[model samples]
Target: MLWEVDQKVKEAADALHPSSNVDHMQNILQDTLIHCWELLLKRHSATMQIDAKFQDLLFRALDYYVVGRLHEMLWWLVCERCQVVDQLVKTRLSHLRHAHLSALQLGVPAHYYTPLPAAVVELASLASVESAIGRLQCVHSTIELIQAQAKEARVTLHQYKDQEGEPELELTKEELMALLTTVVVQAQCSHLVANIYYMTHYVFSVTEDDPLWKSLGLLRNTLENIMKLDVARLPQPAKSIRKELSLQDLMQVSAEVESRFEAKGPSRSIGDITALDLQLHQLTQQIQLSTQAHSETHLTERNSPSRRSDRTMLSPTQDNSKSHSFREFLSSIPSSLRESLRRRQSQQRSAIQSSLNG
Candidate 1:
């Protein structure tokens, strides 16, 4: 009876009711095994397959059936050893339950185990060989969502065209290009934001600071760089719109990313040159604070040990080193417009000399 039920389960394919049929078979086999000690050796022998060892042969047969093998010929060797069938059923059920729970936790689709009738493929980006299967599952969900949306849009568009005339559906060439550009820019920004948020979150969640934090720091720097680049690249209206939208909300989605990256303070991930200028102002303040606490002279210029001058008075080595470092720092300040800074300083010095002469 257990063997017959197992055969039926195999034939059912996706329709297999393991909860009812499979469990029932396992229980019947377990009860039979518990009572079979009183039976004659010949009576029990008739139940066993051609193999001399009844239980061992049944185990091998049951192994073939439980692992999704549907054919009956593979189990001909152990037809009556109920003990093997019970173990196989228990093992299979345990495996299935584990897989189902894991899938549910990972937001996998319900039919995750119902293998697609196609050749299996692999992805290079998959974390491991096993992840290829998970990625395929993600792809399946994405495709389903896309299909549903496309179908709904098609129906709505057809109805709109019928009621409003085909001419109303067409857009001007410039309008179409503008719409496309807006879409492309938004898509790119969204991708960058996602990368920044995840990378930041991954970095701060670690207990011991790993080199991965450097990678995260690089990402944060890149985000700052991109924000500047975008500000410089995007049109004023678009830049204003982005500022109005609040880029911090994007970073704040993941908790760890939010904790590591402050939305307030002087540093901002995106905006005008003014925001970056504010950060530079803060750095200059820190430098002044350190110098006031330690250095005797205002322009001691303690940058490199090799470049440090022995004389308390300014020397070419100290002056040149300070000038070089200041220039290097100013190079990052785009709007300071170096030529203007040079001319304005020269003008100020002339004004001071004129006052001394008077």
Candidate 2:
């Protein structure tokens, strides 16, 4: 049914040319295509798997349709049909394929299985899926390149727009699209492919005393440092706004900015914003060190006791001395309730002294 309808639509389209009577021919072709789509949906609804496969087919097929606009159209269609799946599957199918097997074995669907680590199997499943997103760094680089190119092109075309004579041929929408597509493809090829390999090694290249794994472990502490620096260096938005505003507007501006002020009221300084960025870079180094330490600590915890005891047993005198020392340390400590009360009293005294000094 679909094939016959598609044939009719094609025949109608073939009968028309750019210079021919397009209006009548387009109406006929549109009717044929709409009818074919309706029949296709009817056949799709008749089977459970057919409906699923049709969704997949449309999802993949539309990528080649009208330079990627149809993919969004297919998305709306799937949404209307309530066919949304896991976001990991939808957004990061490539990364999801590389995710731990635990993710794959999650749902109790009939087709689900103990996943094997075969890129081929994952690729087969994803053959009908959209292309994976390019890396962020790639997009960043591409934007920089495009801006640079645009600036250079603008410089070259500066005289063309000023001419008062005949109009120059403007770049067609298709031509501009083709140029942007080239840039996107180049960005994906250059950065995303390289970064994927690097990221894969970072995640999976575990070994004895692996430096890469160590670096990843320390990242959170580095982030903490970054946050501290960022808090300190953040621009005093209110002060800058105040400086730029007239006395008349300052009153209204204060009212507008009041809601965003911190507990201490708006900042009256712009000491340094770059320090935050610098600290972030320093944090990366700290993160690397921390990661190494954590991995080393974990490795020690896993293997330390066995190695420590593998040596000659301690002498009875040494063992007794160690045991005695531990008991003495425990006994020297005050009770938890007493310790808490003592610390609270010390804090209260310090607060009172500070208040007196102030």
Candidate 3:
């Protein structure tokens, strides 16, 4: 039945040219979905009464299958006609494939398996659409939810064995990246490159300072970093049963295993937002350090020791103006770095006060 649906979808996709508009593509997909749904219902009605769980699974499977096939067809059309796949798109696709193969090698334990979060699935689905605002909104909401979960230590670490103690409040960057790689592999969404290209070409009202814009950047970086991660370095399941399977073999096994399990109740959260936040902070620090070094060099070349001393010995008004400028600079820093700086400053003040009292 699925093969029949697949054939029909392929036929519909075959009719589309590389220059087809978004609506033409959407209409083909929408019509295919409606037809597939009716076909599935008829087949199930003859055998057994479809329960909610089965229905949910059916639709999800259909969505993934139809969308994936359609995307492949569209990708091939573009490649055949345009004679070029964007280099970044090719890199991402390669990364996703590599990550999937690495994950298969780990042989993650059944009990440890964490299904992709619903929001993450929705994020991928929205990326396929043409609506920039809608996609941005979904991205923002998804990142926010993932951040909340991470803060609460609720994101499951599938690669690690369960411990007797409470979960750690903070996750390291490696752990976060490993979990993200797993989620992306399991998502199996197609046309990632095309979706990203579409968004890049479309102009929207987002800015660099906005959290939404930051979230978008974080997501893109996460996807890119997938290729760089070494699955062997991540914490392994204690009882993993290693299997030597080819990529095709692993994919087949995965599909079979997935079919056996009903979708687990929202098994885990998504996004390594904390890891990305730390990355952003490190980047900001590097820029600040470079600027400071340049300033120091320029100051050393221009100012004599006596002049430097005179400049340092400021009046109350000059000190106030300097402090105001410093505050303004702090305001421009990313929130995470600003908070870290605030904590460090408070700790230093406490230490100085204690020393004076002593």
Each model's lDDT comes to 0.30, 0.31, 0.47
Candidates in order, TM-scores: namely 0.16, 0.19, 0.34
Residue 248 error for model 2, in Å?
51
Candidate 2: RMSD over Cα atoms? 34.0
Ranking by TM-score: 3, 2, 1
Q: In model 2, which runs have C-alpha deviations exceeding 4 angstroms? A: 46-358
What is the per-residue lDDT of model 3 for residues 1-358, given as tens digits with 9 covering 90 to 100? 8689978887887877778864466456545655675567556553342354554456545655666565555545533432232343344444444433333234432332333365457665664553443455566665555445554433234222233466554545544444455555545455443444433322123334767667565655556555344544555443343234454554455554444332432432333223322333344556557767887554223222232333222222223453344334323323222233335434543453343344
Flag clash pairs in model 1.
none
**Which residue runs of candidate 3 sit more than 4 Å off their true CA positions?**
1-116, 151-176, 230-236, 241-358
Report per-prediction Cα RMSD to one decimal. 34.7, 34.0, 26.7
**Considering summed lDDT, which 10 consecutive residues are worst modelled in model 2?**
108-117
Error of 3 at 60 (Å): 31
Candidate 1 local lDDT, 1-358, one digit each (tens):
4565454444443443334433333333322322221121224443352333553334323323332232232122122222333233223223222222121122222211111111112111212212111322322332233334333433443443343443233333332222222222222221222222222211111222333333334333332332222222222222111111122332233333334334434444232223123333444556557757987764433333232233322111223453344334323323211343335434543453343344
Q: Mind giving the per-residue lDDT tens digits that candidate 2 earns over 165-188?
A: 543234333332323332322222
